[model samples]
Target: MEAQVINIMTYEVIGSKDKAVAVIAYGVKTPKKLAKNIMKTHKNIKSVLQKTGERTGVYRIHPCKLLAGNKNTEVIHKENGFSIKVDPQKVYFSVREAEERQHIANMVKSGEKILIMFSGANPFGIAIKKKHSDVYITSVEINPAAVAYANKNNKLNKINRVRNICADIRHAKLEKFDRIIMPLPETAISFLDAAYHFAKKGANIHVYTFNRSFNEAARDVADTCHMFNIKCHKVGEHKVLPYGPGIYKFRIDLKV
Candidate 1:
């Protein structure tokens, strides 16, 4: 039997796979008419949620209100396939994303040449470049289409210091970067070799990983580095995503 259509007041579009979209939250037993109405009002949201091998999904439409008294704030565009909105969502999260944004800004001031692997739309790099003028950034994205959209977003945001490279990050031959950022934990573990090559000795690397235990996940990374005779110390850890009760997505800062 076909499941009854439900109106989800909160939803996200995920770009980690083909047809990246998802309805994250809604009241139980919602009616089809309500779901239909939501789709009608938010015409850009695609229904299918695509999952990449990393098991991470991408959201096409991200909504948040940065102002007071604003009924809704929806970030919608044509770059990816999504248009659903989550009301009352924080427009700017003051979490790890905020910290990473701050760190990017700091690096720009020190004239650090940065490379972002798995940069989807390169929002993290773009935010820093906008605030700091001295830094040069090269963002590598695996998806050609996503790279295109990142370029468009750069233009839309009036940012010019960012260079978008569309290629498989794991095999791309590029200069060593002073700082490297990998935000996607699902596949980040497999891309450590890429990070090692692109990162200069004693460079700062921010990596994401997925594991049932945070310590175990971090230990796996440390072990991976040790095998290569590369000494790495975990400088910090944060819960960037909630996968489950104990299994969570973690971001670890390492100094090589």
Candidate 2:
């Protein structure tokens, strides 16, 4: 008899010695025996969880159901020579965005203050600070759970100077930053006003948007800048990742 198809998740491994957590897509039928078979074949997977719904509420991560193995969703995800303790069930993280984070870190100059908005798990801060130790970094996020993990991740990497705050970034009083990074793709474009207020003259700002085309994403930023009365010229653009069929997450780099 032919075995039923098992949609083995391609989630990135979370720890050394090949430990991983797999999230089964919503509506996928994963039988118990099949889930066991997955663990047998993919020995590295420490657990299996099912995606239940879209990200909503304060958690801002996919609500998942534990299907097999350990119930603990927390794991230490190693990336770019640093480690991040995260729970996919509690906070949003893109395993594929490590390269993008590193690219952002590469542009940081020493002594420049950096602001990372929607800074979930403080991943971008880790990549940037680990690479450029002299620069000051501050992360503002809304979710308390993510902020807790962000603080732990900072200490996990022995990064002592980062300021992690748990509050809506719009209401947070902050100093102007020399470089600003907005990585929250789903709604980051809508927060350009916040970036504008936090930016220093001639400072760099990076915005990520999800749109049908790269041109549309770039145009959106230009229009937002015009509305905000800020002369944020586009200095760079990049296709960070594909959001869906014909939809992409693009990063637009600007100079204030």
RMSD of every candidate to native, in Å, equals: 9.7, 4.5
Which residue pairs clash within candidate 1?
13-58, 13-59, 13-60, 14-57, 14-58, 14-59, 15-58, 45-83
Which lDDT tens digits does candidate 2 get at residues 1-256? Answer: 1111234343233443356676666666644665576678877678877777767765568887887998886877777678888888888876778889989998999888999999999999999989888889999999888999999998899987899998898899999999999988878888899999999999999999989987899899998888888877999999988766899999999999
Measured with C-alpha atoms, the lDDT of residue 17 in candidate 2 is 35
Which candidate achieves the best TM-score against the true structure?
2
Q: Each candidate: what lDDT?
A: 0.57, 0.82
Where in model 2 is the C-alpha error above 4 Å?
A: 1-12, 29-34
Give the best candidate by lDDT: 2
Q: How far is candidate 1 from the true structure (C-alpha RMSD, Å)?
A: 9.7
TM-score, candidate 1, is: 0.67
